[model samples]
Target: MQLASFSGFIKTLFYIIAFYYIFRFLAKLFLPLIVKKVVEKAGENMYQQQQRQQQSSWQKNQNDDTVIYNTDNVKKPRETKKVGDYVDYEEID
Candidate 1:
């Protein structure tokens, strides 16, 4: 089996360091933009929810001023029973 070379080890280490720095640079460049977009989206959703609540409240306010008349209480009268009452007799032993 062949032994690992020192130059190969150095080259691998160099690649790892290079990639780490590149990743950090890209993250610094894009992280703020990503966070800002997320914040704006959350704000938009909150605004939409507030708008929906306002519309629902507006409809409720309109309904509060309206009046309804009920005729059901006057239409139905008390029902009278036509059957006679029965008396039960007990037998004495």
Candidate 2:
């Protein structure tokens, strides 16, 4: 029974060592591929952002050419009424 327990412990220890190396090996092998994919995704997002910026700038230029405005065409800010003219409060009992 003692020999059997010793053998069982040895087996468990061997399994632990094997699992540790297997996980480490898989991480070392696969992590670079995952990182490469993430970098590629980031590049794609950056390219899309640049394209959107170009599109917006082009649209702004087109709109600027179409609009004709002068001082008379622009509207002035409205005058705000005084608080005393708008609100009246009485004491409550």
Candidate 3:
């Protein structure tokens, strides 16, 4: 029969703790670079969108002709015949 040993347990525990610390150290080293790249990409996208909006507005300005319409004769609303009485619902307490 195999039995558990204290030294073996200690070794395993030490390895796990070491691996955790190393992972955290590496993340602290590289997380900022990753975040900075993401922010720069977002800024570039916003700049591109602004440029497109400006170009479209400039194109619209190039065609500034105003067309006027005459609305002197207009049709009036149709008259409705007699209908059923309206019933409004009341909320019960």
Best by lDDT: 1
Score every model by TM-score.
0.59, 0.55, 0.56
CA deviation > 4 Å runs, candidate 2 = 1-6, 66-93
Model 1 per-residue lDDT tens digits across residues 1-93: 998999999999999999999999999999999999999999999999999999997888788987656677786767999798898999999
State the weakest 10-residue window (summed lDDT) of model 3. 64-73
Candidate 2 lDDT tens digits, 50-75: 99999998888787857555679678
Model 1, C-alpha of 80: deviation from truth (Å): 57
Score candidate 3 by lDDT: 0.92
Estimate, for each residue in 16-85, the C-alpha lDDT of model 3 and write its tens digit: 9999999999999999999999999999999999999999977787787765456767777889987888
Q: Which is the better candidate, 2 or 3, if ranked by TM-score?
A: 3
Angstrom error at residue 85, model 3: 38
Which candidate do you rate higher for TM-score, 1 or 3?
A: 1
What order do you get sorting by TM-score, best first?
1, 3, 2
Instruction: Give the clashing residue pairs of candidate 3, or none.
Output: none
Instruction: Give the runs in model 1 whose Cα sits over 4 Å from its true position.
Output: 1-3, 66-93
How close is each model in CA RMSD to the real structure? 15.1, 8.3, 7.9
